[model samples]
Structures are given as structure tokens and as C-alpha cells.
Target: MKAFYDTGELACVALDAVTGPQVFLSGFPLAGSDPEQGQQFLLDHAAEHGHCVLYTPDDSLSLTDLGVLLRSQQVGAARLTRPLFVKEEWLESQYFRDHLPLEGGSD
Candidate 1:
């Protein structure tokens, strides 16, 4: 996986070079800052690449809120967007989670 954007708090990674169904993660720690920047980045990448699946933590902002933001900006067609809210505990089971260390020391 390659990181597209790392803002010290939130990170946008390219899981693979697959042609369809791109995945972008959110909710690192301080993701609330300038949400639109992240939103636009995802949208632009999705448009250029393919369908985007945004995986955000459950405790973080709601997918509905993201949808609202997307709608406000008129990013793209509805079919190109997919948002999945995941529980924090699930990250522990993901092997890739261990490879990408958090901003600070491991918790």
C-alpha cells in the first residue's frame, strides 16, 4: 500500500492498483480539521481512478455527514461513492494496521 496524503493525523492510502473499488481510510486522530480537503482529495482520486470506498471509524464523523459534504461540493455521480463505517476494534485484526504506525508512539 502507498500513502497518498499524510497530514500527521489522518492519512489517505492507496491499498492497491486495482482498477475498481478504491479504498480510502479516515479517522486517524484529528481528522476533523479541514474535512473538505480530504473529501475533495478522495473525490478527485475516485473520479480519476474509479469507485471509492471510504472506511472511517465508527466513533468518527458519520457517513451521512460525508455524504452531505460530497453533495454540497457536487463531487461526482452517486454511483461512484461508497462509505463504510468500521468499528475501531476491527483495525487490530488487520495486518496492514501494524505496518503503518500511528503519528505518535504506538498506543
Candidate 2:
């Protein structure tokens, strides 16, 4: 994708393209933090169409808060993957204890 824009005053620039599924994982100074609207759009469209997992590294909010919003819906799951503090073994144990299916054949 090519984006062309002026450094100063902008001119009318328009282009159209049919793109594939886009995953927008971001954090910022939102004019309004409407988790409900954001969640609804992602759930109704992205998650329903197979994007069940969304990885966000935005530090403005806590993982628990985002997790609650994402999992609030019966359809979507959100995970924050960054500044990972859990040890590998600890993660494995936790995964096995909580998400057994993800443990595969590990006995």
C-alpha cells in the first residue's frame, strides 16, 4: 500500500482498494474510550468471521480491563502479549491447569 501526502497543507487524495482482513491492535489517546463499540465491531465482524484472538500491547490500560471487555462477549477472546512476566514452566503449568485442550498430548 502506497500513501502519498503533502508535508504541509493537504490536497484531495483518494484511492480505493479491496483489501483482506485487517487486524488493528493499538492503544492511544482515544477521543472517547468506547470499549463497547469497539468490541461490538470486532465481535460482529472480525471475531464472527474467525478472528477470535486479538493481541494488544497498549499500556494505557491494564490487561485485566481489556480482557474483561473482550471476554465480556460470549464470542470473542482477547490476549495481551508483551512484557511477559510468567516463566515458561509456570506458563505451561497454568495452561495445562486452565486450558487443558491447549496442552495437546503432554502428559
Candidate 3:
């Protein structure tokens, strides 16, 4: 709800809500955050992975109403850290490291 966004707690609460049209990740890729930072990345990946939205709150809705709205949205799975994990793996791979020097040095 309004308070959630105002307080910047929507992402934390959305983690447990079911995925569906009703629920959507809202925050954009904030400064110091990666390109895919907010709900859009989560929602797109969730749908790609066969998930659904259960509920969503307006940017200014109250957190107290989350459960009811979520239930009504009937949103399914919640895509939390899946995208981060995928990105982490990519960042950890040799292909990623190939572009960097293991130590500080000019090759």
C-alpha cells in the first residue's frame, strides 16, 4: 500500500505473495542497483518460469490490506531471488571472469 512504497518495504512483502496479474514488482532499477532491479524483472522471469501473480498494491496502499488484495488477485507463485541467482551464476562463470584480470595488473 501507500505506506509500503512510502516506507520502501513493498519488495520485502511482495516476496511471499502469490504471483499473478494483481501483484506486480514496482520499483525501477534504482541507483547503485543492476539493470533489472524492481518487479518488472521479477514478473517477466516469473511468467517465463510458469508463475502467476496473486495480488498487487497501489504504490500508496496500506500493507494491512495486502493479504486480502493478494487473495482476491489469486496470484500464484512469488519470484523472489531467482533472477538474482541466475545473474550471480552468470557473474561467477569463467566466461564472465575471462574479461577481467585475476589481480590488479596491466596485461
Candidate 4:
């Protein structure tokens, strides 16, 4: 894990074994990326649709991780794009076009 992080292979690698407390890889809103990690807020607001001051928790984590890895290492990845799961209706809507001028999403 340390070797992966030392090299440009991974942005941040938290190991479970060969060490102390297992390194936990949990998603945090770009907003709540603080020590709290939004755990308290999410628990408080059980009905809220969020994660994330970052907008989409899952997508944000993946995209941000990839971007950080590339920029930090100045390296290229074998795959440039990732598959996403989104609402079919949203993709067809004007909002998707205006906001994300990308190709289509996965089924």
C-alpha cells in the first residue's frame, strides 16, 4: 500500500493489514471532507438526498480520485473514462446537455 502511494500508481492507498488500524476508504463529500467526514450530518438528516456538498457522492469520489491521481503523478491511465449509472430521463433532458456535455451514460 505504501509502495503504491509512493509510486504514482495510486493517489492514496490505505492499508488494512501489515499495520495498525485498518485504513478505511470511505467517501466524503468534497464539502465535508473534514475530520467529521459528514457522518454526523448524514446521520442527523436521514431523509436528505445528499452526501455531499460535492453533489454526487459516488461520482464525485471516483472522478476526483482519478483526476488527483493523474494530475499529481503527471501520468496517463489505461482507461480515460468510467462507466456511470444515472437516470435515463435525466440523461435525455436538457439539463444533462447543458451541464454535462459528455456522451451517454451506461444502462
Candidate 5:
């Protein structure tokens, strides 16, 4: 879809997340029938939903700090991708007893 403005900005980024081409997956849908309004509605009522996983890269770190509901919900960030998950599963396997993280949690 053709975006009207720079998507890194708040409104545009929100709209893009609702309707634009996704990098990792496709066919992701918003709550309403119309994409724009659906995004706006969700943003306007963010507290009502659970399991809303917001993925923020370094550029959007400030977003995780806003909104009372999201303030304390920010988990740790990582540069991880799909392969990292596979590697983590492998690292946890019985075959890799020597590859576990250190006692203090440093991997």
C-alpha cells in the first residue's frame, strides 16, 4: 500500500502496522473492517486488550516508556530473530550440557 507520509512517525507507523507490508509475516489483521480506523481505535483503547506484543527496535525505545499500561510491561530487548529461537532450543538440549549460560546468567 502507498503510505502518505514518513512511516517512522507515530500515526503513520501505527497505520503501517495495521495495513502495510509486513517484514516477517503476512495477513495480519486489525480489529475493525477499515484498516485506518481499526488502528486508531486500538490505539485509543489500548488498555482493554491483552497479549499486545509491541516490537520496538532501538529507534522506537521511547514508545515503551509511554502509557501507564505499557510502562511496566516492557520485557528485555534483543537482536534476536527466528534462527535465534532455534539456537536457543538447541542450546537447551541434553546434548549441549556444556553450552549453558553461566551461573550468574551471563551467556
Candidate 6:
């Protein structure tokens, strides 16, 4: 699940690729500071779907905030993977970083 937030309040959560990647969480206030709540929210939506990955904008949270959220999910037994807080450019760079050929290959 990918989450989009503004000033710490969760704005959206995408459940799957088939959902087309733009589902906003409505009708309630979901804050990034509240990791336990975030964990529960994800579990509620994605429990049967297996482990979850939360993607947020870089400006939406700091590393410390994300660490706290990860710790909370671990404590709560939520099957959540690491939260990815990054800008669009960073993601593009990451794609290249992941796919770049190694200098030393089988010769």
C-alpha cells in the first residue's frame, strides 16, 4: 500500500496495481506521527494481501518519523515493509541505481 500525506496527515492509500495507484483516504484524519494507527489502518486494508509497503513523498516525513512508524508496526505485529519516503526524482535515480550493471561481472 502506498500512502500520500500532507503535513503528516495521511491523504491517500493505494491498495493494489489494479486499483490504478490513486486512492485517497477520506472521511477521517490519518496522521503519520501516529504509527500504531497507521499500522492498524494498513492491516485493516491489507491484512489478507500480505506484507505492505508504504510510499510517501519526501517532504511528508523525516527518517526519524519513518523509523518510529516502522518500530510501531513491528511492536504491533503488522506485516509492513519499510516505508519509502522519496521524491519523484529520487525514485528515478533509485531505478537506475538498482539496475546499473556492476563493473566486475563474470568474464
Q: Give the alpha carbon lDDT tens digit for every residue of 1-107 in model 2.
A: 12222355331111111121122345321122244554455455544445333333321121221221121111124322112112223223433223211111121
lDDT of 3 by residue, 48-72 (tens): 6555333222221111212211111
How many pairs of residues collide in model 5? 0
RMSD of 2: 18.6
User: Could you give the candidate ranking by TM-score, starting with the highest?
Assistant: 1, 6, 3, 2, 4, 5
Global CA lDDT computed for model 5: 0.24
lDDT at 20 for candidate 5? 26
Per-residue C-alpha lDDT of model 6 across residues 1-107, encoded as one tens digit per residue: 46555478653232321222222333212322255454565555454444334433322221222221222112243322233333333333445223222111120
Residue 63, candidate 4: Cα error in Å is 20
lDDT of 1 at 96: 33
TM accuracy, model 2: 0.21
Give one clash count per candidate, in the order shown: 0, 0, 19, 0, 0, 0
- Per-residue lDDT tens digits for candidate 5, residues 12-98, read 122122232333212323311232333333354444444232322221111122321111111133121100111222223344323
TM-score for all models, in order of appearance? 0.25, 0.21, 0.22, 0.20, 0.19, 0.24
Q: For model 4, how does the per-residue alpha-carbon lDDT over 10-107 read when each residue is reduced to its tens digit?
A: 32332111221222223423221231333343333333543222233123222222221100110133212222223333333445323431221211
Model 3 ranges with Cα > 4 A deviation? 1-36, 59-107
**Model 5 segments more than 4 A misplaced:** 1-32, 47-107
